[model samples]
Target: MTGNRTHLLLYAVEDLRKPLIQQLLAYPQINYSFADTPSELLFQIAQQPPLLIFCRTTERSRVPTSTPLIILCPTHEYHPAQFIHEPAIVDIVAETDLMRLPFIVLRELREEHAIVRETHRLRTLVEHTPYGVIEVEIDSRQIRWSNKAMHHLFGYSAGEMQNLHIEDLHPNDIHTTIINAFQQMSSGDETPLIHITCLHQDRSTFFAILHRAELTGTGKRSSSSFLPMLLVNTKVSAPCKSMPTGSNSPCARLIKDCTISISAVVGQL
Candidate 1:
């Protein structure tokens, strides 16, 4: 991991004013970069953020950033709750703690690196998977994630389904069935792949092979939502042939007028 040298950013008006800057540079494993002004510091952080930032608190306003920050101030002025409570603000330190700073920086850096590695690995796995994986909130029916295949089969572009409720994708006749399946799964039932009529963005419909799996380890993020589940859908196929398209059936007329205007009032999409 040390093959790529760790970058440490120090932002202060004067380099000689902070002895810790020179002290940190003495460590061969870390490379140092300096930003003389707040704007310069923000630019560097945005372009290529360092492993840790030791910023001398400035009078100029700063925006919330994802980079881990160590706000340097006098011990009397330091307030952990008020200053370091934000997600990006990792810790507040006084000048007196200069000798112990390197160890704290190293520990936080290692932890952050590990998290990035794991997230990247999971993202790679999700993107390349053969099946279209989807995560949804049971109560709100909000979609959390959808892979490329899901978008293609549903006739939606990337992120189009994010704010859409899962119920909107299904015909009205199957809403009860879908909800029942989730309810059964919540009651500890082993879910099997079921066929359902799913609507495409073009208002066309196809039968989808759907498999629901409860997300047990989702933790508190979805706990209040009652249940969180993963819906894996395979390739879209022809609609069910169970419905007869004979001349006497209403569906036959609906199919004839399919290109004109298809309505869900008669039957499932």
Candidate 2:
């Protein structure tokens, strides 16, 4: 199989009709291979994973976890309930609808390509941005996700930061302030941009501007819960001439503009 063409695997397809064969062969960009037995199919899959698999409904249980599959069911045996809960099954078609295979394959390929492009775009933006981004669980206060810029700002390697809590990034004197801010934000109160002292992995202190926004979960908590997340953005700044007495203090001037800019960027993500 050539790298330029999308490869498809056909497993245990008995009595292949001429029209079905012709329909598959019609696409120049698609290359296909057949596997007669379960062992042969698994061996071929392990050797070179196919873009999609075309398998008989009876053999659907043999399909690997997370591998995209299109079930070929006989017209009389078709039932939507069997495949509805399976994430891997993209679509099901009756044996008489063999000609529609190429169209389904092409559509799935386009969607997969589009997702790859969008993921790359977001990763590029996150890595190149000036501010260090950190995502923390609001309840546990643990660090969940962070960007490369965060590693640079905090003097911590990627693995070192994973086990840290939000309080660990600040000095002992400011733990109360940080906890109060978190509580206020959780209660749906507006948290204005503020200047604070932050600690590096080596325990050195520096002045930085901090902003956070709540990220709510879209799906149920059982499957995956991104809810109650605090998306924190920080940028190192020069020492303030005078400490911030309040939100309207002189030190606020240093980070006033960042409030709107960071919020806009996070909103887009």
**Judged by TM-score, which candidate is best?**
2
In every candidate, how many clashes are there? 0, 1
lDDT of 2 by residue, 143-192 (tens): 77677778888888777877987778889999888777766655556554
Cα shift from native, residue 253, model 1 (Å): 37
Tens digit per residue, CA lDDT, model 1, 4-108: 434667677364346776567556565667777778877887787687776766622363375677777777877667773466777777766676667677778
Which 10-residue window in model 1 sums to the lowest lDDT? 259-268
Find the 10 residues in a row with the least total lDDT in model 2: 215-224
lDDT of 1 at 141: 65
Q: What is the C-alpha lDDT of each candidate?
A: 0.60, 0.68
